[model samples]
Target: MTAGPYPPSMIGLSDVPVSNLAPPTGALVALAVAQFAAISWLGRRCEPALATDRWRRFLDDGNAPLMTVYLWHLPAMVLLVGAGLLLPDLILPDAGLHWWLIRPLWLANCALILVVLTRLWHRFETVRLPALGTRTGPATALAGTGLAAASIWYLWQHGATLNGAGSAGRIAAVLALGCSLVLLACGQPRTRRDAPVRGPELNVHPVRSGPAA
Candidate 1:
C-alpha cells in the first residue's frame, strides 16, 4: 500500500523525496515480520527474573515522567525541524559516510531536546486540582468529562491545527484542555477528612502461645 513521506532519519531510509513515492510492500512486510520474530524470540528466551526488583524500580521511574515526555515530544520534534530549516549549513550537507555518522547524532540531539523540555514542562503535567466534594457531584464530573471528550473529538476531527480553518480547532483544543482541568480538579479521591467516617468496627482475635510452649 502507498504511504506518505515520514522522517527518513527516524526510519533509516535514504534521503529521497517521498511525498509522491510508495515503498515496496515486500520490504515493509519483511521489516514487520523480522520485528515480530525478533520480539517473539526475545520474549521466549529471556528469563522472568531478568525483571528484578531493581529493574522494576527503574521501569517505574521511567514511567512516572512519561506523561511529560509524551506531551512535549511532538513540540520538541517541531522545534528541531524548525531549527534544521533555519540552520541548514550546520545541520544539512550530510552525505555518504557523514550522513550515516550524523544519523546517531541527530537522534541523540532530538532525545536530548526532548529530555530537557520534558523536565521543564513536567510541572504542568503534575498539576493537581481541588478534590471533588458533596458540592461537586457526579453530574459535574460527567459534564466535565463530556466537555473534555467533545473538545478532543473536535481537535482530532480538525487535524489539530490552528491556521486557516483551524482557528475553530484551536478553540476546541482550549476548551478540551479547560474541561480536562475541570475533570482533574474534581477527580481526586476524597480523604477521610472530607468524607464522612463510619462507626468503629469490633473484631476478635485468638492469641496463640509461642509454638504451643
Candidate 2:
C-alpha cells in the first residue's frame, strides 16, 4: 500500500525522530567577525584625527542622525517587501521575464525603503540623541535594542525558517545578530572629530629681559 499524507512509520509524529539541522555557514561567520575587527581597528587608529575643538564638538553632536539610520533600515526593508508583493504588477511586471531578475528588483525596492525611512527618521529628535559621556552607553543600548526587536519582529512575520523550536528562539537569534552590528558600529571612531591644535602652554611664551641687562 502507498503511504498516506505522512509516512506509515510516522503514525505518531511526536514519537518520530527528527534530523538535526546544520548550523550556519562558518565561512560567513568568520568573514563577519573579520570585518568587525578591521573596522574597529581602523576607527581607533583614526581617532586622533578628530582632536580639534570644533570637529570634536560636531562629532559629539551628530550621533542622533547616525543612530536613526541604524535603527530603521530593517523594518523598512520588510515594509518594502510587503508593498512589492502587494503591487507586483506595478513594481515588477509579471511578464515573461527571467526569474533571476526579481532578485535585483527586490534589492532596489529595499534600497528605496531605506532611503525613505532614513530621511523620515532624521526629522525626529529621539532618533538623533547625542552619543557622549554616560548617555552614550544607554543610547547605544537603546538603539541596539530597537533595531534588534524590529528585525526579529520582521523576520517572524515573514516566516523565515529557523532551527528554533518556536517564535522565541527565532526572535532571540535575530536580536543577537542585530545587537552584534550595533556594537560593531558604536565601537568605530568618529573621524570627523579629529583636528590638530596647539596646546595653551605652547602658545604662550615668557617675557624675558634683553640678555638679562
Best by lDDT: 1
Listing every candidate in turn, what is its Cα RMSD in Å to the true structure after a full C-alpha superposition?
A: 6.8, 14.2
| lDDT for each residue of candidate 1 in 1-213, tens digit (9 for 90 to 100) | 334333233232235433222443445566689999999988777648557888788778888898888888888878887888987766765577766777888888889999999888787778885456434557767777777877777764554556775597677687677977666466455567887878888796997668753
lDDT tens digits by residue: candidate 2, 79-190: 8767768777765565556445676877776778877887776777465455533223556767666776777666645445565557675666676766756563564344
TM-score of 1: 0.58
Clashes per model (N, Cα, C within 3 A)? 0, 9
Please report how far candidate 2 places residue 163 from its true position, in Å. 20
Candidate 1 backbone overlaps, count: 0
Q: Which parts of model 2 are misplaced by more than 4 Å?
A: 1-25, 53-62, 86-112, 119-213
In model 1, the clashing pairs are none
**TM-score per candidate, chains pooled:** 0.58, 0.36
